[model samples]
Target: MNVQPPEAYATYKTYSAQLLAWDSSFSAFMSLKSHALTALQIRGAALLKIHHTTATIMGRCVPDPTDPRSIVTAANDPLIFSQSTNDFQTVVSLSQSLVAAAEQDIQRGNGRLAGGLTFSTDMGVVAPLYYVCIKCTDVPLREQAIELLGRCPRREGMWDSVLGVRMIREFWGMEEVHRQLRQGMVKLVLEDDGRWEWSWRDLHNGGEGGGVGYGVKEMLESQI
Candidate 1:
């Protein structure tokens, strides 16, 4: 839990590589224990591999504080954003696979639980899907992830998928407003005391007017 960033990155990378090797060996091993293992178990292994892959990609976003050469901040780091987008794509695929496998189990009456609620002490899909919603550059992929979250009424320890969906939706709205502000479709007004307020440009009204809003600075700062 107290691992240094570099060590954590290396550990995640090792986990990803080892999972790949294990996957390659699974066919031969399954031949001997095909009856012993269920399809869900196989899919679970794949889900674990996806988690490791996600961690490895996330690790790349952490800059080493001790390295002077690692001076590029995340705000301007193209590599970090690119890796995040890749992570989103990978997570979405694995999530779909896992959902399909679970649905199959339900149809065959192998599903363990009943009703719309599920509880698990272990970490589950919510966190990664939430990450995709916030970090992924692709709007459609982010929306897809949110849609997936909405389908599951579950709790993985402290994570609530329903709450996550609400938060992501709010985040999307905020991001759209920020985009509009950047494009000058919305305008921010600086008060005399250095506080920032915002208003719509009122393009239809033919005047630089709208109801003034407070906390614009706070909203912009949160994004930073």
Candidate 2:
């Protein structure tokens, strides 16, 4: 449930209906819904996963000034899995902070790290979506988000990542982006190049300077 603290979850649950209320106003505005994953949602999720991973990695490593140990290590130190009183709190806090950092890093030019507008080194890079677009601006994304705000035809249908990829290709004319999302497509340039999923995983693991994607080096060179 997004790694929130126990209390936060309880509090969040109190307003659960309000938190995700999709009434007539929403449905009226979102009449053009598709059964497939929209381009924005698909790319957004993939990028979100990357950003979440980055936040978790960075947040855990943000040494507690009061304590010498890192959060993850500290969490593991107290007990097998946070049986200690303060251990769990620290873990939960760091997780929440990382998530916030990731969101700020993406939606705005957060100064805490290499913001959306900056080309931070791999180690300092937080979110890849900002870096991926190279042309990402706040206004367009905000509008896009508001436009896509609606329940999918079904929850499980959202897993098909190719929908948004196709949309990206069709609307934005991003052929390579579509190719990357559709892992099964054979590489036009390399005979031995298998599915994009393997290459993407390799790129993801390599972290920064693994530069080279869709004929654009800057697009995919993220810190994490």
Candidate 3:
């Protein structure tokens, strides 16, 4: 995808600030009422997560002076990197809180809504937890997200916790293989250019533009 224009960055910053302001106002309102609504809290945290994740990605963009949308590169600025890390930390915390809140809600529901068969049109905890499971760099936090996904098997819109957990565990296995390759624990045949060609054939075998065909549970078990 092409890089966003300079104006896009400015717009993003404005939106982020507005989101923060709204969250602060909501918090103050809740404090005054001496009660916190779980649904509203979840919605607020999810919105912040979306904004922060976008900010983290945008922080890596270094737009070209001549054509802002045509050229981009990873930023080398320490402050930008710090801000990205802080944003990611916020995502992690929000994901954890969402999972805890969902678990409590499930408990209070008395097992009526704990299974994968339960469905909801409104946004729920599954997507946020899945996002953290796939995006967070912190191992423990990712594991916690995955574990929660496995335990709570509800369906939120099109998001299924069971399938999400499977995908996340598959992702974990892929990350593990990449880490081993980087550490030289995996043998590799390098080309003349000293680059190893990694193929996705083993992961997906429905020919070009095909979805993953293997079962995630089987893949993870083989890794074990």
lDDT of 2 at 34: 29
Error of 1 at 178 (Å): 2.0
What C-alpha lDDT do the candidate models reach, one value each?
0.68, 0.34, 0.58
Q: Where is model 1 more than 4 Å wrong at Cα?
A: 1-37, 64-79, 104-109, 113-117, 189-197, 202-224
Best by lDDT: 1
Off by over 4 Å in 2: 1-35, 64-224
Tens digits of per-residue lDDT for model 1 on 1-224?
22256676677678668766765676567678767877667666666756766665565665544544534454335457665776678888888777666666667787664212377777777788888888777888888888888876678888898888999888888888778877666777666565665556756554434534433334232221
Better of 1 and 3 by TM-score: 1
> How many backbone overlaps does candidate 2 show?
3
Please count the clashing residue pairs in each candidate, in the order shown: 0, 3, 1
lDDT of 2 by residue, 1-224 (tens): 12334675455445444423533344444455523556445334333444443333333322333555655555333232222223223323333344445556566755444223222233221222222222222334423322221111111122222243334334443544555546533222323333222233234544343523333232222132
Model 3, runs deviating above 4 Å: 1-3, 36-117, 189-224
Worst 10 residues of 1 by lDDT: 215-224
Q: Please report, as a residue range, the 10-residue window in candidate 3 with the lowest summed lDDT.
A: 215-224
Task: Itemize residue pairs with steric clashes in candidate 3.
Answer: 116-153
> Which one wins by TM-score: 2 or 3?
3
